[model samples]
Target: MAKQLLAVAEQKARQMGLACDIAIVDAGANLVAFHRMDHARIAGIEIAKGKAWTSVAMQMPTANLAQSALPGGPTYGINTTNQGRLTVLGGGIPLVRDGMIVGGIGVSGGTSAQDIEVATAAVQAFAAAHTHHSTGASRTIR
Candidate 1:
């Protein structure tokens, strides 16, 4: 699962001319596989992993939490919660099976939009490879 997601993310990143660090984590928020493209920023290594972990732990895309978590917002200071392991970055996406998250994928070393693009592509790829039926809809908890 991680291998396919990494391949899909790497290919998508290259297509967009981005050097990304990608990470995958299970439902338990445990690390599974990780990859940092050549010339990728050193900071992306931990950032990507954190994104993946955050997605799995929160059961949603990290981007969804970004706005509300900002200072003065409803979830303000959430970034400081969980000992800073939780991030509100845009690169994290949960992998779902039967409407339940089985894992998550994260991509860093690019703009939030670019990271989302790569990570979304990886999720799409995973959905395609898996035999489980899906509605192909985005998950939102608002």
Candidate 2:
């Protein structure tokens, strides 16, 4: 499943002509698969992984991290105290199956919205493929 997701992410990045750093992490926040496009910012590699790690670790999207850590929120200083390992920006999403989180995906090197768009497309592609295979339904990817 992780491999399939990574393939979809890579294909989407190529299709969008966006150089990106994509990271997939298992439910335990461990790295599963990663691809860093040529010319992507070298510094974004670990940031991307940390975003994915936070998603898998918290079983929620990374965007929520920012909101949850607002000035008076319970998670204030989380991103700061974590030493650059946490980001409140978009690009990380949890992979869910049967109501259980299986892994997560994080994309970097683009705008926050662009990163989310690419990651969302990859997730949608994976879900569509999985649904077809599980239900014996056929569809063309063209």
Candidate 3:
């Protein structure tokens, strides 16, 4: 599943003409798989991984954290609490299967919106695959 998710994300990045880094983390926020596209920024590797970790740790889309991470927001200094591992970027998304957050996916090396777009594609692929194989539980990506 990790490899499949990476493939789907890379395909989307190719379609968008982006060179990016993608990372996946398990429910415990541990690295599952990662890919760095040709010409992708070196820094994006860590950022991608961080995004995935942040999503799983927070159990929410990283984009949503951006708001609360702002000055004077509820989580204004949340980023500073995790050894600076948390990022309020838009590319991270939680992968929920059977109503449980099973993992997370993250993309970097493009604009926030573009990263989000690519990650979303991966999530959609995951959902489709789940739907094709099983029929009972709900799946969500956010």
Best by lDDT: 3
Which residue segments of model 3 deviate by more than 4 Å? 136-142
lDDT of 1 by residue, 5-84 (tens): 89889999999999999999988989999999999999999999999999999888999988889888998888898999
Clashes of 1: 0
Evaluate model 1: give its TM-score: 0.90
Off by over 4 Å in 2: 81-84, 136-142
**For every model shown, what is its TM-score relative to the native structure?**
0.90, 0.83, 0.93
Model 1 misplaced regions, further than 4 Å? 132-142
lDDT (0-100) at residue 18 of candidate 1?
93
Measured with C-alpha atoms, the lDDT of residue 125 in candidate 1 is 79
Model 2 TM-score is 0.83
On the 0 to 100 scale, the lDDT of residue 67 in model 1 is: 82
Between prediction 1 and prediction 2, the one with superior lDDT is 1
Which 10-residue window in model 1 sums to the lowest lDDT? 133-142
| Clashing residue pairs for model 3 | none
lDDT tens readout by residue for model 2, 1-142: 6666767777777787878888988878889898888888887788678778888877788888877788998898888765657777788988776678878889887887777887887778766776776676864431
lDDT score for residue 138 of model 1: 34
